[model samples]
Structure formats: C-alpha cells, structure tokens
Target: MKSNRFHKQLCAFLVTAACMPQAHADAKKMWVQGSWVNIRQSADMNAKVIDHLSTNTPVFLIAQKDKSCEISWGISGHGYIPCKFLADQVLVFADVATENSSPEKAKNYSPTRAFWIAPSMRGLFNAGKYFQENLLKPEQLNLENGSVQDRPEPQRPPKLIRYSVPEFEAMKEMMNKGVIAPVVAFAPLFSCEQMQEAKRRQVGSSKDEFTRSSNDWSAPDAEKYPYSYIYAHDCLVPEIPKLSLPKIKVSYFKDVQKVLPGNTQIEEISAKFGIVERGSVTGSPRWALDYDTYRYTGAWDIGSYTLTLDKPVYEHVIGRTGLVAVYRWLPGIDEEPFGPSASCEEGLRNQRNGKELLSGYPKVKDALLWFQSATPLSFRTAKINSRAYLAPARSLKEGEEQRGIKKVVVYEVDLDGDGIADFVQWDMWGEPEISGPSPLLTLRQIFININGVWHPFERDSYGECT
Candidate 1:
C-alpha cells in the first residue's frame, strides 16, 4: 500500500514537471541592408560604374551569420546578392507576425541623416595609417660629428586621462567657446617651464629629478628638446570628432506577465501607479523602449511599489523565464523646477518614506522608485553618494493636498518575434488636479545596448522654451 502511494506521488510530480512551460527562445531572424559605395564593372576592375544607389534604398535581408549577412537588393535589376558590411545595419526586425514574410518597405527613412560608425572600424583605418607613418619608417638624424644616419627613437606610449562628468562638461564648454588659440600661434609663446610643471603635476613627479635621470637630455638642439612646441601642438589636438555622441542600439521584448495588485490593494495601487484618478482612467501597462533600462511603477493601498530592471520582463508574462536585474525606484518628495538647479534632496526624502513602507512589508526588497532624470532634473543616481542623508516628509498646508504623478514610464521592448527589442512605448498618466487635457509623460534618458555593451542616450541639443 505504501509503495503504491509513493508511485502515485512520483507520477503526479512527473506530470506537473512535464506541463511546465519552457523559456522563450532567443534565436531571431534579422535583416541587414546598406547602400553600395562603389560598384565596378567587375570585382577587380578599377573602371567607373554608373548608377549610385540612394542612401535609404530598401534591401531585403536573407540571412545573417556572425557580423556579415546575405542581402537582396530591392532594385529592379538586382536580385539576391551577398555583400560584406558591418552588423550595425541590422535595424530592429519587422513585427512578429511579419517575420516569416519577405522584407517590407522601410518608412520615414532618410539616408542624409548621420548614422553611427563603430569605433572598431575607426581604429582599423586610422591605426593602419598611424603604423605606416609613425612606426614603419626609420628616422633619419644628423649627429654632432656631422654624420647623418638612420636612428629611430623608441615610440612614445599613449597616455590615458580619467575625467569626472563636471570636468568633461567644463572641457566641452571651453572647446565650444574657442578659448584656446591655434597651436601654431600659441605653441611659440607657451613656456617650456609651464609645460614641464603641468606634466610633473599630472604624473606626480618633480622636474629636477626627471631632467637629471633622463638619458636623452644630451642630444642635439632639436632632438634634445624633442618635446618642443611643434610636437606639443600635434599632441594637444585629438584626431576624432569630439561632437559625436556614443552609439547605442535598442532592443525590445514583449508578452511578459504583468504584475497586478492583489484584490485587497487594487484601489490604492491604481492611484499610486497613475491608473485611475479623480474622474479619469489611465490605461494598463504598455510596451516601452529606452536605450538603457526598463522601468515599471504603480501604487498600492499598503504602499507604492516599483520594479526597475535592466531588461524587459515581457517574456515572463508570456510564460517564458530568464534572468533579469531588478532595482527599486524611489520618487522624490519635494517639487522642483526643471533646470540645472534641481537636486536629489527631494528624492532622498521620498526614499526615507519608502524605507518605512518596505519595513512594514517584508516582501518588498527593492527600494523606492524615484525619477532619476525628469524635466526638473530631480535626482541623479550617478551623481549622489549611495550613503547620503534621506530627509523626512514635512506637513503640508490645510488647502494643499497631495498631487498625483503626471509622468509616463518609457520602455524599449521587442514587440515583434525577432530576437531584438525595437519597439518603444510611452505609458501616459493623467493629472487629477489639473483641469486641462492630459499631458504625455516624457522620458529624460534612454538606455541603449550596442554590440552587447550598454550606454545611456544623451541629448545632442537643449530644447527651446515656449
């Protein structure tokens, strides 16, 4: 009898295990397309070829292996043709339903707009020239005895400088202001003593010791002071374009399980997450895509809950499972302006309340959900120390009541079945106190993943004020 019961339990466990859903497949089909630069009469020919392809010409992506892909040109004459191009051309895939079909026409695409080029490509081309010019040839020099011989000095190593955000911002401002004059004009007037001082300070070394210890100090006028104005001028300027922003690729994911409040706290959760208000109803959680991170937040009767993650969790809702990084979002308590003067003090205050709320509920592990970057520049997690002080909320006037959030959470997700997340969504919230039409929530920063590395999207120019 005991053996029969054990066998029955074992059968039940096996059945349950078999019924469990599997994780979503990561494999995805992507398209690769690019403009033809120079097409010749033959592969090896140097002859001129007519008919340059336009920048936004649509090309069908047949297959992608590693970084290269087989593409079919959409041109009337050209059929299936394979071309060697970088992986950056693989934009987000078509919607999942259309994945199996032929490539669709690209809309609102303009080729004249600048596209990002990978740094690896830049290094390949620039470093090749640098090697030939600086390393391959032997240096010809004249000795004090009037003898000319080929003498190549050892190559100077590259220097790396670490800079803070403020310092970088200052340097950019200076460069834009053109405070520094041309090296040709300024180098002649620059004192070697000042340069030596700067170098000594930078490296934490003294000049007297450096000069006495150096072996190349006895060379001819030019070679002895090889670190002169002409050399200094060349070293000061950088070869790459400083204005270019970091390149990042965005991926979207979809069909993830949505976490709704339990039956008890539905009303509070609705108000907290900006679902229902005085008379309006904000829609359910929508898809969103930012270059950097995925965020979701809503309030509950017990307290407000926020779930911030590095990647979207749409797959989990759709019965798929994968690892995801989680963070607690803590909103600020104080109302601040949307400018440079905004600080993290208000967010810190809100975090204190969040901590209390968390202590009350043992299940809550992640901390409060605070707006890191908003119109008013409320809180910057990167700028503030993790151990900074969190203030307590103060009492409000009799007439003043709590104002609900009027912002939306932006997300980047793969709405299409393609392995990459390309879709972006803005979840809007209504302002209960305001009488006018509902305002669309704006996203201040976007997270992007380019070539498996993550980066934050930065604004190129400041927006004009109305």
Candidate 2:
C-alpha cells in the first residue's frame, strides 16, 4: 500500500515537471513602444506604474488581457504591460542563469544609464578622423619632422562599412516600435552645446532631458566609438532639418572680435543672432554669444529645436539697442507706449517677463555644464529654475482678493516683420507678496508660432532656465 502511494506521488511530480516548459513557451518576447512605457502593477493604464521601460527594451510575455498583457521576467516579476504601447517585435533578455529572472531582474539593468549620446553623421565623420590621426596612425607624413619615416607606412584602415541591410532593418524594426534618437558615442567628456544642438534635431515634444528622447528609439547598441552604433540607428536620418527660427532674415551679423565698439550702432544690433560683449567678473570684456540669443521664443519652439521670429515690426523705440538688451522681447519693446510704465501693473508684468523675473545668463551658462559630463543629457522640455506663477488671465479689480500672481504683460509683436505677428511675450508681472521687495518682471509664458500652432515656454520651464 505504501509503495503504491509513493508511486502515485512520483507520477504527479513527473506531470508537473512536464508542464513547466510549455508554460515558459507561452511567454512571447515583446518590445516597449514609446520612448517610455510605464510598467504598471496591473493591466490598467491608470494603475500605478511599478517602473518605466525605455524604447527598445525587451520583455517576456506571460499572458494577454484586454487592454494589457502580463509580462514576466521570472516568477515574482510579473506585471501588466499596456497593449497600446507594445510593439510586435519579440526582443529577449539573455539571462545567464538559464532560469528566467523575475521582473525585479529588470532593475539590474538600466538601458538609459549611458543612453545620452552625441554622435552626428558629421560628428561620426569627425570621430573617424580623430581615430585615424590619434590611434591608427600616431605618426603622420610630416615633411618637417620625418615622423612618417618612423614606421612602415601605416596601412590605411578600410573605410567604415555602410550600415548593412540587416542593421537598417534592425533600425526600422526598432523605430516601428518607439521614438528613434541620435545615438551618441560615449566620450570621456561630452559637449553640452553639441547635445543641445542634437536635441533640437531629435524627434520629440518635451524639452526636458531624457524626457526629450522619451519618444526616441532607445539605442541598445551603445558600444565603443566607430562600432556598429555609428550610423546604425536614427543618427543619420537626413530628414532632420537644421533647427532655425523664422525671423524673416533681416540681416546676419559678423562675429564681433572685441567688446562691441562703444558706438551703440543700429546695424550691429539688427541681426537675429550676433556675438556680444560679456565682461568677466573682474570687469574685463570678453566676446560671447548674444546674451539674449534665445530670449524671444514662439509657440513653434517644439521638437529638438526652438526656431525664432526676431523680426518684430517696431511701432516706437523699435530700434532701441538698450531696450532689446533689457527685455529680450519686443512687447517689452513698446513697454511704455505699447503697454504701461514700471509703476503701473502693466509695467510689472513686462518686467517679470523681461530679465527681471527670468535672467537668461545663469540658465544658458549652467546648461553647458550638463553636456560636459560623461553622460550629457538633452531635453525637449526642461526646467530653467526661474520662478514663475502661471495662472489664467484676470484683472486686478478694486476690493478683490489678490492672488499670488499679479499684473502681467501679454502682447504680440511681429518679431520677423512678416506682417503677421509670430511671437508673444505674455504674463510678465510682479507679485510683491512672493517676489519679495523687488517687483518681479516675468511673463506668464512666452509663445512662438511654429507653422500655425503657438508653443509656449516659461522661465524655469526648459533646461536650466534660471
């Protein structure tokens, strides 16, 4: 009787073991679609996101539900992934253990840790040049030094292979699922300016770091430079246009060499971009990009770039270089006649929008630091750190309670002389209560027109906006 009981238990164990492989087979490999998709505790979109996976991340499917699917890394690592953000590809994670790890295993890998890259096709071309000069051939055919005679003429390395059809298909496969971004080669020191330029060219709607690439195809092919990563993914998409604003080209200025000649000349200040005098803290003058280069923005300031319309039709004081220096926007151009005086509520509004509330100096300077880091991040939407109070348009009536925000400046200026105004400097205001003793001059938000839609940017809204 005891032997029969043991036999029955052994048969049950054998049946259970046989079913395990079939259960594992039910898990189909899947890819995350958007730049990021929340890993939810349950299948509901509204359910709490346990975590977020980047574009091109791979997961194993456990089972399917109506709007979502149960994804499994291992036994305990199971959660509902939304079906809408999922793609058809089945990219799998290779676990050394052979036994599938749990969802908790996902935390062990961060696909985006070194994700911020700075490779342009041009940059790649430049890097290859660098590799040739520095690593491949340390000594060059210098007529002066005879360094070329030092070693057997270094065999010119074969030209880098163009991305193969397989690589291109890999790209299309990844792109079909999520946002595709420029894959930057990891550099010991990355350039913030270059990454910022790339950000302007990347595809996305947000302006913050990581957030900008939130929709881009997450490059899983990050390796040492000149590897398959270069030109393999979306890094070489020719459709990406050089970012520029529609400032009906009034004139282009020459880069200034010295402290702009003391002559406050009109022609010097007319261009949409120019080099200006920025004195060091010790009061020594040095040339720098225009202090207010990107101050005047429009609604069209989305994607990887913020195009501008600097050609505003000036009714009065239209050509005041000093005024332009003070308010970067033209609404502040006709502040006195077009709007109000400093003592009045309108004046405070313009001031808030002008440099008073949002100083462009620190914001622009601080951003460079981010790019210099080993992992430089770009943004679609970012915080500038300048304090701003965003609220609806309402008048400060007599005997009415005053909200935290008071007195704003909002007006349209034809920044590019296009007859149709394309830029707006709005909500520049002063709230003595929060602004403290000084009257805060800041716009509620600055809008620039792109195509037809107006995109808005506020102080502390985009990267390092102080």
Candidate 3:
C-alpha cells in the first residue's frame, strides 16, 4: 500500500503543467519570465548549476521531470529549469515602485508575476495606473486559469474599412456569374522531407498563408514532379495598375562621360538615377518614430543610390551619425573598376561605414541635393521573375473565401547564389480592414548572407519552399 501510494504521488507530480505531451511533440517555444533563472544538471534544486538564463531567453520544452522541465537552450546544450519560470506567451515588464533601493539590489529586482495583455493594448496604457484603475472593474483576469473571468464586451461593432454594399454585392454577383475569372497562379508546395528541411533551416510560413502539416499533405509523386516545386492554381487576381509603383524615369547624368565634371557633390552624384515620381522603393519611406527622420528615393541610372540623413526632427540628439549613403553599381558584376577594385561585399561595407567619401560630400543637410544615374554594366542583368500568388492583401479580413480569392505578385531574385531565390520583392495595395489608415505594403526583403549561409530577416511576410 505504501509503494502504491508513493507511485500515485509520483504520477501526480509528473502530470503537472510541464508534462504536456502535445507541447513536447511540437517543441513549443517558451520564454523565461523570471529575472535570472538557473539551469541545473538535474531536476533537483541543489543540482550542479549548468548555466544562468536571462529573462526573455527562448527555450524549447523537451519534457517534465518532477517540478523541473527539460529544455533545449538554443545550441547551448540541454538542462532542467523550474517549470514555474517559463511562460507560453511573451511577458512584458514595467517599472515597479520601490523604496530605498540601491543599485546593487536593483540589479536583482525581479517582479514576482506578470499579467498578459492583448498586443493592441500595448503602449496605449500606463501599466501601473491602468491596472490600479481596472483592478476591480469588469473583465477581471483569471490568473489561475490564464484567462479573463468577466471580460466586458465592446459597446458597438468594430469599425472596418470595407467595400460599399452595392460594390460588394456586384463583386459577388460577378464571381458567381463567372464574369471575373480565376487566373492561374502558383503557391510553393513542400513534401514531408522538405518540410523537415525547412524547419531545420528556421524558415517560417507566409503572412497571408498558413502552411499545412506534413501529415495532411498527400505523398508527392516523384516521377511526375520534383520533390519541392511551385504548385499552380487558378485564383482570382485583380489587376490594379493604379496601386503599382510608378515606373522609374530614365535620366542620365550628363551622358555618362561629361556628367562627372560638375557633378562631384552627393546631390549631383544621386542625380544619376532619375526621380521616381511618388511611391518609394520600400513602399512608404516615412519611418514612424518618437522623433522625425526622413528618407528620399530616386532612380538608378547606372546603379542604385540611397542617401540617408540621420538627423532628428523634434529635437536633435548630439553625436548622432549623419550623411549615411549607399551607392551600388547597376551592372550587377564585381569585375568593373570604375566603381571599386575591392570585392563587392568589402566595397559595400566601406561605403556604408563612411570610409569612402566622394569629393563633393557635404557638411550639412541644407546643401544636399539628389539625382539618379548609374554606370552601365558589362555583364548581363540579373533575371527577375514575376509570379502571381493567391495570398490576399490586407483589405480582405471578414470573409475567408474572399480572402483566398485575392492575389499578389512576387518578384524574386537569386541573391544567395543557391540557384533558388532567396530574395523576394512584392507590393500589396488596399485600404486596411482595421480602423487606422494602412501604410503602403511594399516589401523588399533579402536573406542576410552570414558566412555564405543565407538567413531570412524576421518579417511578417515570407516566401520560401519547404
């Protein structure tokens, strides 16, 4: 009876929050919420200390052992940490009121518990004041169950930017009548093995599309098609030329040879690439910050040139870097000497680091001017592929079927030398479904080349085959 009772207690302890088989199978990402959590060699609290983990560090929960969790610490080896210190969602912290706290004591000031809030509520409320005001209000948080107990409902329906009733009905009628035909588009399809490879590479799903699990996908016919290929589909894609980026104007800087005589200044230098009527290359160049910063875009006559002013708008911050500029050879080849003798990567770094400055470089923003031009390349131009995808724009939010009908055009380039495209450029045009005005959805993202391995930068939208 004693042995059976001990066994029951052991099962009870093991069946705690850490013993989630589904989470272990999925390798669910969890964050360390404690100030300074310790990783131990064993599940015991007094076990040999393996390492110290800082708050917000990500760990993969492997399994549960007593009150501790076996976690994979991101290439740092496996160890056990207290399950209480791990949170399924990210925890944001605020400054707490303290009395007579010294710097030494403040270093170890870890808040006991943190409350989860909707992402939309972030930055809108002062945490301390908001919590104090709403503590006894309706919508009390049920911390025990990680849910809200008496959540209050909104007074009215959320205001959405939507089409008029007539327009929406007309679109539906046309779609039903087959007047608006679904065009042939393509989506990346991955096999089970390919999906595993994608997970190993840390490739994420597209923002507009969710990747289905490998088990749900049928076995790919190897004889008929390659293991991973772009699958074609018929979808409704609207042709909105008004939403597209305006074509860049072609204006050379004084016929290439004569252009250099008077055009030694940065403004004259930038003039090589002609003016790009209105829309920026990165869609909306207005970067929203506490203070104002400006970005201007122009054309690449011979190559692309971007000049940035890191000056403050509201109040200038002392010692900030200024007049940062980037100039690239349009020819897409490294052999040419009219630009530089160093390797492409090294030369680009030099330009960014402000090491290489032209004779006409200015001292202040007042004298700055820009034009667009570039040196003709001896090599052939990089190939650009424009493919249509079924991912909808930000406009379609209410109807799932209508969302799948919307289409986007993706421009791809092979920047990583992997023969497969590692860079994607695309533009989404529409009013957002949400309340606030939508910014231009232009994206020009590339896989960062680190020691020859291309890694995609963190982004909301992504395009890669599993």
Best by TM-score: 2
- Using lDDT as the yardstick, the better of models 1 and 3 is 3
After superposition, candidate 1 runs with Cα above 4 Å error: 1-37, 40-58, 61-71, 74-374, 377-466
Q: lDDT values of the candidates?
A: 0.24, 0.31, 0.32
Q: Cα deviation of 429 in candidate 3 (Å)?
A: 42
Alpha carbon lDDT at 242, candidate 3: 27
Using lDDT, give the best candidate's number.
3
Candidate 2 local Cα displacement, residue 357, angstroms? 26
Model 3: residues with Cα > 4 Å off, grouped in runs = 1-28, 92-357, 360-466
Per-residue lDDT for 304-354 in model 1, tens only? 212122211110111011112122323212111111221223111112122
For residues 307-355, what per-residue lDDT tens digits would candidate 2 score against the true structure?
1223321111111111221123321110110111113232222112223
Q: lDDT, candidate 3, residue 454? A: 30
**Alpha-carbon error at 161 in model 2, in Å?**
40
* Model 3 CA lDDT for position 251: 22
Clash number for candidate 2 = 61
Clashes of each: 36, 61, 16
Segments of candidate 2 deviating more than 4 angstroms:
1-109, 112-401, 432-438, 442-444, 458-466
